[model samples]
Target: MLLMFLSRFRVLISGLSIALFIVLYGFFSMRYVPLSIPWLRLVDFSFWILSLGSCLAGFLDLYLFWRKSPLISTLLITIIGLSITFFARLLSVFYSLLMTSFSIQILGGSLIDKESFVITTGAVAGSFLILGSTSIHTIYKEPIIFLKSSTLYDLMNTLRNTPIVYGSVRELSNDYYIIH
Candidate 1:
């Protein structure tokens, strides 16, 4: 049962793991990176949003995985994850650009300015690293193979055979209408 669940949500699990790693790395590495810009708050906020988006995407993937049709769900989840990653990358790039511009303006393109550019570029690169790792892991993981197991196959068949209906009935003019 545990294996089945893991296989079904492997993509989400792997993606979350990568995101966690990035978050942890950023947390620990922040001490070493100098904060000269006044707008560091904005960068921090963007990073928080990136982390939140990754987590939400993971949950969305899990929700879709349990639905009746998983192939389409998987596709949708993949697209969502990719989109989230892309947005995060863009945010990071924007943050980096701001940092670069600030550094150049204040430092007159000195060694400090170069350092800021490197730091910002590295931050954005880290996001891409997470995306690449998650993509590779998702591509190689065999979630569909789990569906072939006898137990899972039977369970899915049973679920498909069952019909779920929810409705409120209203009577008007000697006729009843069901709204679901």
Candidate 2:
């Protein structure tokens, strides 16, 4: 039952993420204006907006559904999302430096330019958030059954008498024995 619920929730998140991305992309693309600083370019602001929305969705999911400390899980997930963005930016800088030092040439001379850097960073962060929020790690917990005294004794006796058992024993809550 819980698995089914979570599976549906994941699908809902995926749909919402796509919808949000589309809206943000349209808004940013239409209102984009060239700025002096390349880093502040809003041409692809949709990606950043999508990434942030994903992270916020993930945080809310964790905080609401998480069985442990909701606050801690929410905080940790948020921090991890931010850290991913930070790492991606740092890696882009390193990549730029390496490209300048080496003679590696692709379609263009500069690979990790400012525009690509923002796009890549936002994409990575957004992907992480979407995945983390939708994917759940859950421990299977068995339900406990309360059996009457006579039924319990008979069940135990039958098990004790059956010596050569080739299969595992599973007791149903009701008083029915299914033999194969």
Candidate 3:
């Protein structure tokens, strides 16, 4: 029931909400003295929207995975990486932290300008987009080949069918499976 509702209305709601945000952002950015809001506030709100959308998409991806559709995860992650490229243009705390942590300077000079930042962002995002996508495609194509379990193979034979997947674990040990 819930899935049906979501399937029918999700796209409509998402489109409307994004449109509403753009409209509100433009309205707030206008030079009208009485209605104007801070640019930083608008940016913060937009970031929150992106974060929330990514999280919800993650949850939906998990549900879809159980239904034997694992492709959504890769698509969502790629989209998220692309969004980060756009957001990196802003002078946000995350961008500052990355720049400071990595010591990214302009050709060994002190100043870091916009062009260098944009180039670095694009390079990193593009590399991940390419490599990450191929890896995800491989994993989805044949998950069990990587699991490497003869016992799992025997169990599948006993059941007379091979399951589509058995996902990764944190570590290969008895301790890793303990709840506490």
For candidate 2, list the clashing residue pairs, or say none: none
TM-score of each: 0.28, 0.34, 0.36
lDDT of 3 at 66: 31
Which sequence of candidate numbers ranks them by TM-score, best first? 3, 2, 1
lDDT against the true structure, per candidate, is 0.44, 0.45, 0.39
**Superposition error at 117 for model 3 (Å):** 12
| Worst lDDT 10-window in candidate 3 | 105-114
Report the poorest 10 consecutive residues by lDDT, candidate 1. Answer: 105-114
**Span of ten consecutive residues with least summed lDDT in model 2:** 137-146
What would the per-residue lDDT of candidate 3 be over residues 110-138, giving only the tens digit for each residue?
11434433333342343344235334534
Q: On residues 1-180, what C-alpha lDDT tens digit does candidate 1 reach at each position?
A: 555554455446445655664665466457445444433433444444444444444444434344433443233334455455555445455555676674442222222333433443433343344344335435754224323223323345654664536664443223323355
